[model samples]
Target: MPQTVKLRPYRLADEPAAVGLWQRSWQLAYPQIDFSQRLEWFREHWSGLQLDSRIVVAECETVPDHLAGFVAVSPRTGYLDQIVVAPEMQHRGIGKALIDAAKHLGREGLYLHVNKDNSRAIAFYRKSGFTIAGEDINRRSGAPVYMMTWRPAADLPPEP
Candidate 1:
């Protein structure tokens, strides 16, 4: 892992690398799924989904044009559509950094639907202060998923 990881807004130039990272991350997480086949679809919706959202990308200083990970969040609705981290970059705090950025952007709350079978992600979200509020099925994949959410703590009255 590199000593420095920087976060920035997603640019049109980062499209290919971002799309590639999305594929690689999903492939590593679920080898049974051929994510390469979905590259075109992902590319099509990558930026389209971020139209009213903030897409943040994390890059390693050690390697130029290296995409460590990225998170796409909609502050308007506090919905997090995607958070993908490079396989090699896992456990290096890049994922956490991306999530932190998401939290900052979606201040009202952060909501996301993660695959139910993805225990690693579920656990990570829990550790990051998100809770499983409900469940749903992915319309495209028909996979079971948990609707998780995180809201900043609010101050209570000093005395009731």
Candidate 2:
């Protein structure tokens, strides 16, 4: 069984761990991209989220300081800018926990753009109650992507 993980507000001190996790996770997903080259790229985006997003980190139950995963949601616009889980910690419910956290943060609705080729992530989002609402290209990499949105069950429209 997977160990329990506790979610908490992100602190300034968590930046290094959080960013490291971000890089490692992305590197595993898109190995062709050298994420290390984008450290400052991530820092710029992280700085923006730090100012306006509701950032939450999942802490390992037994290993207190070990960050298993994290999610960042813009409270004002409900955009799920980032959700990452450590490569070693994938599929242990950490990602789901982070999604649940983002759901609570974006009470009305949540929206995000996901890489089109990442079927694993796309399937995960679909299973999480998010539907593909549109399509677009990734601004940074110009890769094709899909727009996904999610709302609380109670807020969903009645079935036909």
Candidate 3:
């Protein structure tokens, strides 16, 4: 049987692994960007954010020593700041579990911005029930991003 995966709050000890995951995932998803700049951005934005804002790490029962994935949520907006699974461990339900946990925390809905050119993420978010709410130019990356949102089950469908 497949091992169970546990989701728990992120600790300061997990920073290195989390940063490594962020670096690798970003490199795979946005290869054209300058590496140093991307790292700097992550260091500045992610590092400075309120840690208790809602960050969780996933670990498999069989190999509890390593983190398999992580999700970070903003307290105010309930927005998903980041959700990344190890490259070798994608599509094994890690992302879904993390998302479900976020929803369970009373996050009525969630939203995230994805680069317009990142078709893979766009597809994944769509499959996960997010719909494009609008598009806007991202000054930092010089790329257009699709602002996607998942409304509370009782809310009306987002107008296209």
Candidate 4:
């Protein structure tokens, strides 16, 4: 991990790095699925999705152009649309930083869906204070996913 990882609002120039980061992370997480086929779809919808949500990126101070990870969160409903960390950057607190940023933006709660088969992400979310809220099928991919949610109070210190 670098000495500093800065979180900042999404910028237009960050799109390419963001897309590449998402592609690599998703590919590694879902090896059975060929994300290349849907890369264009992600590109086309990237702008619109971030426009409607709070998108934050984690950048290492040493490597300015290298985007370690990012998270897309809806402030209104606290829906965590997406969070991806570069394969090389996993387990280094980038994802947690992104989640913390989402909490700051959406005090109501933070929620997201993870593929049922993604045990790694499930465990990570569990460690981050999220619980399985429910299950649902992803409309586009028709894959089963577990809806996970985390509330601000979940991590509050016990009343003394």
lDDT of 3 by residue, 50-85 (tens): 454678888777786578888888767777878898
User: Which candidate has the highest TM-score of all?
Assistant: 2
Sorting all predicted structures by TM-score, with the top scorer first, yields 2, 1, 4, 3
Which prediction has more favorable lDDT, 2 or 3? 2
**In each prediction, how many residue pairs overlap at the backbone (N, C-alpha, C within less than 3 A)?**
0, 0, 0, 0
Candidate 4 achieves a global lDDT of 0.85
| lDDT by residue for model 2 (43-79), tens | 9999999999999999888887889989999989999
- Please give, for residues 38-135, the per-residue lDDT of candidate 4 as tens digits: 89989987877877898988888888877889888888888898888888887788888877787777777888999898899999899988999999
Please list the residue runs of candidate 1 whose C-alpha ends up more than 4 Å from where it truly belongs after superposition: 155-160
- Best candidate according to lDDT: 2
What is the alpha-carbon lDDT for the whole of candidate 3? 0.78
Q: Cα lDDT for residue 12, model 4?
A: 83
lDDT of 1 by residue, 25-114 (tens): 889899999998888888778858768888999998878889999999998999999999989888999988898888888878889999
Each candidate structure's TM-score, on Cα atoms with residue i matched to residue i, is: 0.92, 0.93, 0.86, 0.91
- Alpha-carbon lDDT, every model: 0.88, 0.91, 0.78, 0.85
Q: Which residue pairs show backbone clashes in model 3?
A: none
Model 4: how large is the Cα RMSD against the reference?
3.3
Per-residue error (Å), model 3, residue 84: 0.7
